[model samples]
Target: MVNEPSNSANGGARRPWITTVAILLVVLLAVGAYLKLRPRRIRISVVQPALQAVSSSITTNGKIEPIHSFEAHAPLAVTVKKVLIKEGDRVKAGQLLLVLDDSRARSDLALARTRLKTAQAGYSALLAGGSQQQLLVRQADRQKAITDRDAAQRQLSSLERLQQRGAASPDEVAAARDRFSRAQADLAQLDSQVRYSPQDLARSKAEIADAEANIAVAQETIRNSNIRAPFDGTVYYLPARLGAFVNAGELLLQEADLSQMQVRAFVDEPELGRLAVGETTKITWDALPGRTWQGTVTTVPSTVVNRGSRVVGEVLCKFDNSDRLLLPNLNVSVTIIANSKDNALTVPREAVREDAGHSFLYVLQGNRLHRREIKLGISNLTRVEILSGISQNDIIAVHSFSPAPFSDGVEVKIVENPS
Candidate 1:
């Protein structure tokens, strides 16, 4: 009994040691696992949401064109005889710019005049009673007819007297009366031929008028041989060369009043909907580096077209070019301000992301990151407007270079924090 009590006491002591050792082992294991499983720090760049003005704009390529321009063309085929102005010469309205050889035009005018004169002469003769020779001939014919008729009447009377005296037959008296009647009819026919009928007079007058119209056209052509400036402008282009034969309606020169210029902005089709008339625009030219010009959207494109490799809509913009430094047909760049908001929460566009068609971003909370779904209002190429999710002071990941990339509950270290 004594030995059993001693053994029980010893066993109880031993049980306490075993329990304490097992607890220590469990603690050590737990500590090792925790050290192994702890999240690693990732190097990344972060930025906080800011409160500033945000704008939604469209930037695209454009070309400069003259809003006020004119192209001169030859009106007739003629050899250029003189070129009074050179390319890039300043000219005024009604100034003589060129002259064409008028030999052909003059010959044409002479022929037209001759035809007109001849037609008028014939027309005038037809208008007068008749030619003197024709009148004299007609009068002579009438007198002869009168004489013949009188002689016939006298013969008829003698015949009739003879008949009455029983020395002529009744048939002879009838023949004498018929001869007198025939002589009177011939005189009447000759008189009718001497006068002009209304139809004949109308035909002659129309011929004369048609000839005169031709003369007028020829005269106008001769006048047009001299090319004159229709407006005050700079002759930027002059294709008129001395002794060069040019056809009618051929381009002679081009001019424009360079007081103002236009820029044709070609916005991508996807970005075209944001364009509106009267919108403020900024323009730049590659040739003139570090310079910008201001303008307004004067015209919005009604349709889209394919230009080069892009599908774009051409928007017209007008600007003040009073200095005349900007030439026509120069390529330029255009930036159109579509929408803007002031005192709004804004963030870098690079920080904002999309998840399943929903706007999202990785926001830093303490040492860990949390995926946040956000709502946006307006955005430009560089910055975006954050509407609902992020606060002004919240830090969001802009870029990451660590092997362990961004994810929920992942620890991160900010290599750069640009507030």
Candidate 2:
């Protein structure tokens, strides 16, 4: 009977330990079963893999700029008094866009008109005979000169004959000789007086013409006070306000033909050979979503490379502006089709991944995912051209719920999409 009750208590303590171990073993088995039944996460997209004619195009970033942009400036200095057009108003060629105070111009024009009139009058006078009094005076002087010359010649002959016969003294002969010489000189001077003095007449005429020209120039300057549109365009900007004083060549407005819109895009050096005049282009704008505008390469920039960095040159594309909505300075993006090939295999762009300067994609066959190395060609934002390593029907996983390291023989299940 020794210590039998204490032995029962020790037995009970051992029983508790055995029960705790059994519960822990059951919990472990339950956890392992839950993990085995858990679902795997996978992302799937509805993809269409096909072979069709695909054009290899180059996409570049660029901005929309007007083909005809110009700054309207005043030809002469004047105070602006009234503006006819606002910032966004369409105007025709020769339409008045603004008007200056023009008092100065008017005065100038009046002066110019006077000059023109004077020039015309002077020109008229030149066409008609010179002054009658002047003509008469010339005729009289010419006649007098002829008479004096005749009398001098007669006197000289008489003196010579008298000296030869010794009827006239030597002194008398010399005196007659002097008188004849003096008469000849007077006749020559009279002859000169009869003709017009070229210098004097020319000076007077030139003075009159100059005065007339000044007045005419003033008139033309006044006419220019009314600033007119050079072409049919919209007044895009007007810097001068009414009653504002402006100087010659000051900015009046910036006008551009909204109807004449174009796209200018730059390319990298390596792609220089791909662009040429008459090549087709596809234009897209963030402002106009989902719509692609057709354009043509109208001008290939002559600048082949950057002078400093030797980068590629810019190319210009012209599209018909029929909609009349395209404006200057609107941003745009362009795609240049370098080549086109029929039945080229292409896949979604997101399917490709980069590794060590090579492109690759995960191909799904049955339940296995295989990493397929690929060579790429041209690519748009939505699709990429597949040059090699993938067939038309091969299923390429575009997205995954979790990206983890996978062995070669790893199996994956594609998640179903909601109907």
Candidate 3:
């Protein structure tokens, strides 16, 4: 048989202090009522998808370069005698930019002229009759030959008559005829060699032509010594100064027409395949803030190359820089408008997340969140396009960087806006 305690003993064992126990029980009941009457709290906001304009652009770095440029060089060894055009001076085509020491060229030209004069005189003498002294000697020889022939003829006639009269021998008569024949032969020789021949004329003319070519070359060299602008442009580089000695083919100056410019933008090799001509480009220079220049894609990249530390493809952009604000080799920022659209359904970029090559969004369904994958289209910096898996009125969650992010299916209060 089990022994049982009395009622008074049981009561005493159960309660350390009945009055204190009653007080604690009442406090707990009060706390339970207060908790049931209060509302849950959350720090988040919900917004429906918006139908707005969306576009995308490719931003990159580029440099400005002149379209037309000319570099002048010395044609022969020369000293810089004068510098007429300074750096940054605008000049017209054919304007004299500088002058090299032309003394050597001038002296060479004088010598060429003297040679030309000599050649011309020789050519003229060949074309005209023989020279004065030569003509005088030929004429005197012809007259002497004529007189000797006449005397020989008279002697021959006398000898013939003497032979006929039987007072002279046949041998004497034959000697007189031979003398006459010799005189006649001498006169004929003088006549045949009298004046200019065709061969002489041709040789003298060829020498004249050679001398004229030399004179023309010397004049051209002298003209080249005076450096002149090849086109209307601004002188940007001047390496030659007064009294500076420069050798042939050495750089003297550089000038360019800054009205038309090219913006060379280097793009990553991976992104080069998407580039195409006729794309619009916007340019900005750090040196001149708040100013923008516009251009169009003139050429697509043909090959990839290593530029600095990156393997990139270089693109050419053409711009009408008539204002002369853009300069050569100036680093600038470029933004290309690859594609754009108006009145497209879009969402804030922050609400989109990427997972396994697909984008997702957390939707505010009821008091909890739902995870849904979405299809995207053209996206700009601030907005993203939602093509499917969502509607215009669907509420999406937005996560902030400084706060503790929310998880899917978490209970949340509908705070239309929480700042």
Of candidate 2, the 10-residue stretch with the lowest lDDT total is: 39-48
TM-score of each: 0.69, 0.60, 0.64
State the lDDT of candidate 2 residue by residue for 311-419, as single tens digits: 7678888887766666677777889887777777888888888888988888887776788899998666677889988888788777655554433445666765633
- The list of candidate 3 runs beyond 4 A from truth reads 1-43, 106-220, 365-368, 400-411, 416-419
Best model per TM-score:
1
lDDT of 3 by residue, 82-153 (tens): 999788999999999888888888888898889889888877765556676766887899999999989999
Better of 2 and 3 by TM-score: 3
Candidate 1 per-residue lDDT over residues 1-419, each given as its tens digit: 66999998899989989999999999999999998788778888988788899888898888888887888777688789999999989899999988888887788888888888887877777766567787687689889988888998899999999998899999999999999999888877776674788988888888888878888888887788887887888898888899999999999889888777899999999998888899989988887889888889999999889998998998999998877777888777889988888998988888888878999999999988999999999998789888898788888988987767789988888885534
Which pairs clash inside model 3?
Answer: none
- How many angstroms is residue 208 displaced in model 3 relative to the true structure, after the best TM-score fit? 12
* TM-score of predicted structure 3: 0.64
Local lDDT at 298 for model 3: 95
- Each model's total of backbone clashes: 0, 12, 0
Model 1 stretches astray by more than 4 angstroms: 1-32, 39-45, 117-213, 362-372, 390-397, 400-419
